[model samples]
Target: MGMKDKFQDQAGQRQQQANDKTGESREKAGQRSSQQRERSSQQRDRARQDIDDTRDEMEDRFNQDYDA
Candidate 1:
């Protein structure tokens, strides 16, 4: 192959490598974002459950006091 053709081939290979890396990075970032969202959702659910449990316990105590 001529020198010009060889140079173009090498440039094309480098461009392809860069594109592959970019795609992999984007996939990894998406996975991390999804995991973070899931964790936040779980935390909110737990907080709501805790609040409901506390409210029920307090109501039970108040009823007992009134009964006695």
Candidate 2:
């Protein structure tokens, strides 16, 4: 092959490798974001449950005071 053709082939190979690496990095990033979202959702659920429990306790105390 000519010098120009050899250079073109090498450039194409390098481009393909760069593209593959980028795809892999993007996949890993997506997975990490999904995990973070799940963790945040779990935390929000726990916080809501705590608030509901506190409200129930407060209502009970208020009812007791009113009855007395």
Candidate 3:
């Protein structure tokens, strides 16, 4: 092949490699975002549970004082 043809072939190969890498990176980023969202959901659930527990405890304390 001529020199120009070889250079063109190499450029095409490089472009394909770059496209493949970009696709893989996008998939990885999506996975990480999903994981982060799951973590945030778990944290929110825990906070809600804590709030409920505190409210119940306060109600119990008030009842005890009222009874006494």
- Winning candidate number (TM-score): 3
Give the clashing pairs for model 1: none
Give lDDT tens digits, candidate 2, residues 4-59.
99999999999999999999999999999999999999999999999999999999
> So what's the TM-score on candidate 2?
0.76
Count clashes in each candidate, considering only residues at least 3 apart in sequence or on different chains.
Answer: 0, 0, 0
TM-score of each: 0.89, 0.76, 0.93
Model 3 vs. true fold: TM: 0.93
- Candidate 2 off by > 4 Å: 64-68
Give the candidate order by descending TM-score.
3, 1, 2
lDDT comparing candidate 3 with the true structure: 1.00
lDDT of each: 1.00, 1.00, 1.00
lDDT of 1 at 36: 100
Model 1 local distance difference test score? 1.00
Which lDDT value does model 1 have at 41?
A: 100
lDDT of 3 at 20: 100
Error of 3 at 13 (Å): 0.8
